[model samples]
Target chain A: MNQSMVKVFDIQKDDFISAGEASSSVKKILKQLGVSPEVIKRAVISMYEAEMNAVIHGGGGKGYAEFFKEHIEIIIEDNGPGIENIELAMQEGYSTAPGNIREMGFGAGMGLPNIKKHSDQLEIKSEVGKGTTLKITINF
Target chain B: MEEFINSVTLDKDKCKGCTNCIKTCPTEAIRVRNGKAYIIKERCIDCGECIRVCPHHAKKAVADKLEMIGNYQKAIALPAPSFYGQFPSEYSRKKLLIALKNIGFDGVFEVAAGAELVSAETEKRLQTENFKKPMISSACPAVVRLIQMRFPGLIDNILKLESPMQISAVMARKLFSEKFGISENELGIFFISPCAAKVTAVKSPIGIKKSAVNGVIPISEIYGLVHESLKNTEDDNQTNIFSSDIGVGWAGSGGESNALSSGKTLAVDGIQNIIKVFEQIENDKIENVVFIEALSCPEGCLGGPLAVENRYVAKSRLKQHMEEAKSEKAQIKPVLSKAITWSEPIFPSSVLKLDDDVMIALGKIEQIEKIEKDLPGLDCGACGAPNCKALAEDIVRGIAKETDCVFKLRERVRQLASEMIELESELPHTMNRTEKNEN
Candidate 1:
């Protein structure tokens, strides 16, 4: 399929105030693009979950969204501490977030699971001492 | 194609081309074009937020006049529950019902009675049917239309029940005709509405083929006449009683949900707040909520633009009136009637389409985004549109130009200045010498 547009946003770590801003912008763009509501909803949900994961876990991250004729691809990469146990991190309700972050009503550990549930294709890559990268694709 | 008729209209003479209405419009249906606020008919839900916020009183709710009732041999007034809240608590409900008779109505039927019936019917449906979790209320026509225009995916969640106004009109016309030995055509059933949306519902029903109500009279228009009649009545002999406290409570927010003694219910008032709840619903975040009563007007019907009293005051009066009711139980029982249910499927109004083709729409979106980047993002509405984003959309649609943006125009002027200087510097040596000599 032909690539229509590519949008990128640099997300700041622990910036709760602007955490969902990038995802919301992508959703607005998709809506204006006349993507089906169902597709937009799934893409928005997956993008939002991944964005939040980057903000809460990965130190600071950058989000990139590519729109194509048949699908939308979202890639989020962060320089924060990488996950040691990918299997446990993907489990629902399993969180490594500190108590302070948990007190803020997030970190219920459903982020990666929700992203996987909403996305047609989800890929996660991480290094112990390096950063984590997540790629989510939602097909129209 | 049938011409679309909207109950809310802009009075050009009264309009100051202010952005107040456009900003307050939940659906973004109003646009200030050519120094006049114009309502886009297809996009409008007739929520009356524009009418409520318009400083110049330019927005008006158009409904049938009192004189229209004179055409029929007999007329019955189907007074909405909000109609009672217009008066003080000191006035008896009976006196108010009698006032309708004094105002030339041959008979009076309480819409609250229909509310009670609808409430009971909805409860039964909730229990019997294995339908979707959160069954949305179809009472507010504006909310229904909002779902159609914006939340089309949640269309199946809306309950297929006729509004109390429609059911009352149907029952009122039937009973009035039978009692007076007159044909149904000779008897007019008029709804005393609290909002402009109800007027539109009567004129152009959403799911139904035809509206049972012959006309709609806004509460504000007849408040003075009703007050006069209430003062003139010396005896209570002509008073007729109808509707219980449960029925009367339907005037305020959460009234319908309160009446439904079923599963968990969520009642949200105000267009913006309702939209937020609808978003949550659309996201599947709310799973246990059995029913949702969403009202476009703040504090429900009491806060309708056409309502005479303050919303809080009206709510208090309505509560007091409900407390004073003689019967705690519903006076009218629910009946199994076909007229109380929707006759046809409610289709979504796809007003959000940017273009017919996906590729073309995506192209337009790219153009809009490019235009948006050049805008100031102030959302000042100075460009005769709602905001910078809307201006960008208008530009993409060919309704506006890039130079139409004030900031963009300033930028152009600055660029032009730099370009002129560059052109001056690039001039040929002879031409430069001649220009220097002229200077």
Candidate 2:
């Protein structure tokens, strides 16, 4: 079978209305590429949630997703306030976001946890003053 | 499965082509293109928010027509427990059953009976430590799909129980087929539905792939038929269709909780209410709140858009009916062994793919970084996406380009200030020459 895949995205922060836009587009590309629904859904959920974090908490960031024959990879990086404690942040319901964010329907602290749950491999690196970067890979 | 079960339909005539739905949809499910609105099947949660807000009434929930039931020799009406709230207090369960029969149903089965079974199964499952914390209710198929799309991580938490309608349909069909020697095709079970999600559930069921029920009859159409019949059969109480407790009290929000078991469970009516509970659950604040019952419809199923009476009125009437025909004891009988065996498991079909390898994904991130450096941070959806990062993801997906975003492009232009200056210095001295000639 011929394997054809090419897709890219750039994520920006504070875009509430279009927070999941890139994820949806990636989902569309995966569908067109005929990726299995299971793999596509996981990648979309993980990537989308990450993208939301970048927007809501990352101050602003960029997300790049790639579709390959054996897997899907997503990288999100931002210059926003970086994580102070990676381990504590990974815990569910440990959000530092202000209450206003909660009103907008986010900051339940499920972002990183959900990312870990859906992805085959996940990694996060951050500098408190510099920014945070998240990388997720899903194997088909 | 009916191939074209079209659970949701848009009235092209009424659609004004507004992108309101496209913008508001949590899943980006609706796409406005070619001057009309279309639901991208893979993305829609069928929350019925569209159905609720459409100014033109363009969005309609596609359900079974009453006339179609004629195809079956024997048809059973499996009314949702929410249906109890649709009539007045004076209305009798016997009359309601008679009304269904009067409208041509061979028999009527209370879905609350099915709910009773599900409540028991859920209670048993909740006692296990292995069960995912804060298990989600499967009764609302829309909620199930929402998790599948947006919160796949929480998918494990979704209760594996078959919906009440599915169970009742299975039982009702088995009983009818075995006793009367009727062919499965001749026995039709129709769910009097409250929402579009139920219609979709019947079409592409979750835990159980194929639905036992054949068709869905919207509650709105059946309400008038039942109402008119009740007035006609005012004096005659001959039809003992719904066995008291099985029929009445099923409509109100907490009725199911009350019927299932009074203690150690919680029932939340309406999507907003459920969302609040979910937030609490996420905080790990709601403990011992086992077997949370969530109804997408406010006031429980009684508030279904297709239901006959106002939700408040229906709720009151339902309470009165339950009081009038109170069941002395809650039936905890084991579900019939033949009730749908857990056979087919619904697995999510994967669709996400990485556009490149790990290194390539890294490379794209670098490019995204460069692009982010040059773009404005405003996440205004004016660029057609929800925000700048979403726009970046769109770039990676090839669905959109960085240039598609006006703010990004403007920032890019601003960032090239040095080049702009160099170009200005080298620009044809046309302006200078023109000025000299004028002087």
For each candidate, what's the DockQ?
A: 0.37, 0.06
- Model 1 C-alpha lDDT versus the unseen true structure: 0.84
After superposition, candidate 2 runs with Cα above 4 Å error: A1-140, B1-6, B178-181, B234-252, B258-266, B272-286, B328-341, B349-439
lDDT of each: 0.84, 0.70
TM-scores of all candidate predictions against the true structure: 0.90, 0.66
Residue A89 in candidate 1, Cα distance off native in Å? 4.1
RMSD of 1: 3.5
* Candidate 2 lDDT tens digits, B53-77: 6777788888889987888998888
User: Tens digits of per-residue lDDT for model 1 on B243-318?
Assistant: 7887798999999999888759999999999988987676555757899999999999999988899999999988
